[model samples]
Target chain A: MRDWRYWLAEQRGTLIALAIFALMFTIYISNHPAGLTTNVAQTAANKGTLLALVAMAQTLVVITAGIDLSVGAILVLTNCIASMVVTGNAFETTLGVVFVLFVGALCGALNGLIVIYGRLQPIVATIGTGAIFFGIALILRPLPGGTVNETLADAMTGKVFGIVPASLLMLLAIVLVVWLPFCSSVIGRAAYAAGSSETAAYMSGMPIRRGKFAAYTLGGLLASIGGLFLTFFTYSGQASSATASTYTLLSIAAVVLGGVSLFGGRGSAIGAIFGAFAFRAIGDLMFVFDFDALWQPLFQGVILLLAVSIGALGLWRVRNRLEWFG
Target chain B: MSDTTMGRLSERMPRFIRRIEPPVAISFACIILLLLFGGLYSSAFLSADYLLQQLKVASFLGVIATGMMLVILLGQIDLSVPWVVAAGAMMACAATAYGPAATLAAVPIGILCGMLIGLINGIGVAYLRIPSMIVTLATNAVAQGLMVVYTGGFSPRDFATEEMRYLATGSLIPGVPNALIIWAIVGAGMVFVLTRTTFGRAVYGIGNRERAAYLSGVNTRRVVMIAFIAAGGLSAFGGVLLAGYASKAAQGMGDAYLLPAIAAVVLGGTSILGGRGSYLGTVAGVILITLLLSILSVLQMPEAGRQIIYGVVIIAMLLLYGRSPTNQ
Candidate 1:
């Protein structure tokens, strides 16, 4: 029983977030009366997939003790580029998608290079890049109206096997194939080591600069995936229409809520996925309650504060208790 | 050997120039560039009227930057500047609606609002041990929320009055902005506080090492609180002037100042990680950034081009003056 208690405490943030999600789902199910239908489950799963992808990307950067303020900008820019290239043909759409992801990677690489070689602070560097990237997106489209091929969008958003959503499958593949291996690799281990103590990492002969660059580059790749999902869900692209800036903050909040420390060095990609779901679920619940639009930003701000505080408090408690345990 | 020495000297010159902080150097370069362009293109750039007009515009940003400089020196940031400015302007305007008695009350109220918000931020960071970035970001959201809820996204017409306009638009020197005078006074005051007061030394001490400062019995919390309150007051004053200049308060007016204020602080050589900075550098940074914008406007560049230029300037400045690789 004591061992179970300790295990539960170790996973408190994830456990609490899950509880909140379940509670909200229950409320939603009771109110709607079409409780737990296949369609409803698929919709929830689809939404969760999109958020999970971005949250996972966010987790990589956060684990390095850096925040990517430009994630939303990258998404918007990629979406804009994709919209501009989509001529409503399937081939063009596929080509455009590839081009968009490439652009996203390039953007991320630029950020990484600047932070690594140019020696700019991550938050400040990202902020400047974000503004520039968003500006380029605006210049490309100027307005919020662009058509995407409806067929492709539907395929990506639709369910597969009558049980699993297509989005969920993509997300699972990313986790199983990409993130899982990366987390177990030497580069990934070095990232956490660097985050925990840069001086010590250096003393230990870890490639700190290269690790940071890789972390940021990976963040960019994840952001591109998020952009693709966003494009799929919206079925179009609008430069001014998307909520990209909000997502940057949301990604950070989700990562932090999922037990990723802002100070870095300790968190999991899986935890971040759960954090994203918790955040999205809260918003879904708020919509169900008919809260005014103006109140939403305020509510989000309040919740983010609470989540960060809890995370910080939990870590502080654990550190002190562990010292006593020792 | 002599030829080698000359080559070495030439290489070192560019490095030295780069080390001199990009904003300051760029401001000087841009001024000369603008002057040359104006001489070639328009007769107006060298005109006293144009110079005075530019100074007037710079003053609004300058006043807020002055207060922002102090906060930045302590290695914390205030994202709440824009809202504080708007609130101050609104308070001043709202007071005028109740006649003279209310207008008198409004000034203090504006200052008080700034101080109160700063106190909240200070408490959260110092006592609760929350990160300043998250605390200030949340406060900014709250302030913006309050503004939207209170004003319903529209400026109150009754808030603007003759008295408020005098503060915003009325110049001490004909053709110079009254805001310039206010900025100068505030700048001088900050110089005094930063240099003359024991409290100022404490700020530096705390910024350098919070633990050491605490051990030495410096009230680190109080210093942080004071810095935030001062920032709040300054931002509010800037807002009041903004309301006057525009003839009314507007939503998102404060949003534009966030990047510029922080940019100015950093440009002025204040370290973002806290500890070691200068008010004079911030003053120079403010003038330089303001001039860069004015020059862009004078060139009649498209908004997109101007934004690109702004981003490039920020990046270039950071590259030039950022902490060295060895230091990191």
Candidate 2:
């Protein structure tokens, strides 16, 4: 039907991302020492889930046409916070999780306030806040040693049944809980409008600032969720600048791979999720193919450049040079 | 403390006199405050040698930030700075294995690598129309990978050539560091370009509005390309000096420059959105940051405290003057 064609066009990026993930995963599993095993699936799912959450966070901000360089800082800070407070009994752990999420949302809100009211560019403002967050994280966890509630961590990271990964299920739950509602809400439309064209959005009386604020706030919340997962997976937290920079870079790469336009307002977190998975698959392929670990960064970089170039190919069709700015 | 008095005072200042911008003035004032504060810890903070030593260090950042300033003025960014810098250092060092005569070609070879990286960045941004941020970042990752593979490990084995060493650390003039003199020459060139040249005017015009600039017959794409290429090359040159200063290149050597360079450019009252900044502001910013770091160390602050203070100070400075209404 014509309606399905329109729907398919809208869903094209997500589908392509999914296809890429499927293809890479197929290659990875076929070459894996133990092919398609639950352990392998679980391991892959665990790693993919962390990036998926961060990439999903990035997707919200990118959708609003602003980049958050501080996502990695928020993740690192939350992880450090969780490591310290998410200890002892069940009540304490739950409290710690809530607190970490709160801190993340607060960080996002601060970034939004600075951008919206302070009238600063997102790039510099986020860089400053990122440094501040990282500093706090360093103070909180000067060394890499803390414990999460093992029973809860185990349940979260373990397989959901005899087959499916719990981390994957958690990712789905988050999508259902946070992203779906946000996507359907009027705020989401406002965000899309703002990203599409802020002046036009403003003229049309769309709630541009509020929409962006919500996007950034939710971005922080989602990044904190990723941080919690990292603490569970590693069983500790370290204020590692290397990890923070890596996550920030890879998350942006994943968002691009997921087909989210850096220009804004053109893709879904679902696409980003698949993109994160495909990205993880690239690294795993390196592991299986016996490529030296040193080659992974280069391999990933090449893939990222290729993906970005493919996205830019459509621009070649623009007849007017001015459209390049548009 | 009162607005009316300050307004009248500013209004009374003659246009030909070139009144100091509040942000730049405040930065200089902050530098003095840092020195005074450090002076309490040690008399050495006020001494000529200590000040010159700080100046020498600031020159490296000044050189890098000069390139950064040009790109920022054009309303674009080159995030590939880290690896471009690394690649430059490594290439210069790697050339030593070819023998002494080839060593003569090392600096040029290093800078050329940087320009090549810049060319790719420029093409992606100018022609392909990929966002500069994303393209530069991807190239950074690629450069990182290339550097990693080249060294075969965490650190490079080659030593800095004699020319590289002298250029970085040797004094061509009595009592003045060669690096400082190099920075001064580069700064003067930046001033001339940004103020005097058609290319420079095109960069400002494009930053203000690319569509309008194109309509006005400016080659917006070419200007953007050249700005990025210049940025990459300058960043690499900074790296070469760094490698030479240390007598060797190391892994992740450029990692430390990105934030500080950006911070210096902004603190000097350059609008992050683009097309507005003075070279003088950047100079003040560089000195301010260097002094701040020195004072923080003098105070025996930990890295965490230093970082926190650094971030807070930048935000405070920006908040003070960065909110001025646009020229329009």
Candidate 3:
């Protein structure tokens, strides 16, 4: 195969996710009462972007062959904090945003510390931290009422030039600023190398710990971004456990659908973004068809199962049955 | 005793102590320490009535943890547990309107519902080669949706039968809760299977390394399926008992149990990575957790604080025992 062919092979998962999202959105738009107008697109973009940011966060940690179960909790925690602090004057809101991002990084750092120094499995470690984060969230907004700066929330969530979504632009900017640089950096490659084979990476003198730590910290920052958007959209913070768990679960599904290998070392945040969009569409599709909201989980579950099962297709191609266990 | 005799005793103790798994020893110590703390908190804490109540509470967690242990032993996880528990309880409760015989059959039928879900989980993981985590999670969501559609997002109206209520809240022997008796019986059976059965041996082998187990003529797929099936059934059984305790099953009642079940298993010295652990350690863990939680409630700590404690305790325990020399 040519070099570009290999690139295509590498990008297959992301491409599939994009295609899936495009197809779903097309169907959604055509079936919609308002069609593909700015209002419809903006509404969809705003909802999808929240999940995309979190899915992007999950993508980073997953690239290091580690899963952060606390992403949604961090989102909730930051949302709660932002509700209290991201208010008052413009300067105060800016400071709140920065502070919320810092809090997220700190949470991610804590997870990395425990996983590395404590030598604990990432899954177990994150589960514990997730609970801790949710606990903090519950304390922050024991009641669901708090305000965000309407000026900021409106600008971010509103349409740009009445044609394109501001949220979509923001997501694009994040991809360029956060993901692209990380993808090309030495640390990012190291993270991938470690995920693929830690022993090899370590033996090659790669800074595996630093790489994974960066992935986790960046993951936290991204999730906080999701939280910020969530606060903007809802105009308040509610420490809803249902929302937290659902987001966490859906982000994983998005990551998988985006063609990011759960086994680690491959895939992209871009793919995950598309995966998130595609996943959100699954719910919207139900609405367009006038299906009851009760059917949403079932549809999401089936799609997730089918998408994940695609990853398992390789098992059939394995000549040795032993490889199936791997 | 002389100083020389004390020195000799100390010198010999490490060798004996080394034979006991660190998590097992630590959990037992925690149980004792917590009991001491409980006694200090109130005179009622040291009484048999209070302790027995604690045991009764622990039994619910114990049953769920037993299934969790089996899945973890196979180097897999079952996130489907929450909904499986719900499904069992909901279906069993729904079955109660038929007649007396149906009420008696409700328990088995509930477990069977869980078993069917487990079979699907098994097929996905074993035959399809999907990761257990994703497969089970997907199933959990599916189960949730199904239950929601069935119940129309409300609590199932059917109540637990007298039999179930008796099993959960009634005492089988004087001063002994029937729930505890049930847990003990289940624990005893699990211990026997782990220590003596070929199936047990296969589970350990697969956990240690599945490829090697497969090559060694162990029916790895079959074993994995059976383990998951058993886990599903047990979780359902726990839910049924919980329903009885509450007098009715509610949507999402099983949600709180998932993490606690995982915590109990890991705290009991069972490796989350699989292939290691003991039922005795789990018993200690269940008791310790229950006692700690009860005391936390007694302290009037808010729900948020209690959650924080649970999370912190799990991580702390992991740091103490989750590590192995080979992994690092």
Error of 1 at A323 (Å): 14
lDDT of 3 by residue, A43-129 (tens): 999999999999999999999888888888999999999899999898898899999999988988898888877888888899899
Write one digit per residue (lDDT tens) for candidate 1, span A189-293: 788887888889889988888787788888888888887778777766766523765677688778877777777887777788878877777766767777776
CAPRI band for model 1:
acceptable
RMSD in Å for model 3? 3.0
The C-alpha TM-scores of every prediction are: 0.89, 0.96, 0.96
- Give model 1's DockQ, 2 decimals: 0.36
CAPRI-wise, candidate 2 is medium
Best by DockQ: 3
Predictions in order: lDDT: 0.74, 0.87, 0.89
Deviation from truth (RMSD, Å), model 2: 2.1
Task: Evaluate model 2 with DockQ and give the value.
Answer: 0.60
Q: Which candidate is the best by lDDT?
A: 3
Query: Which stretches in model 2 have alpha-carbon errors above 4 Å?
Result: B1-8, B14-19, B153-156, B323-328
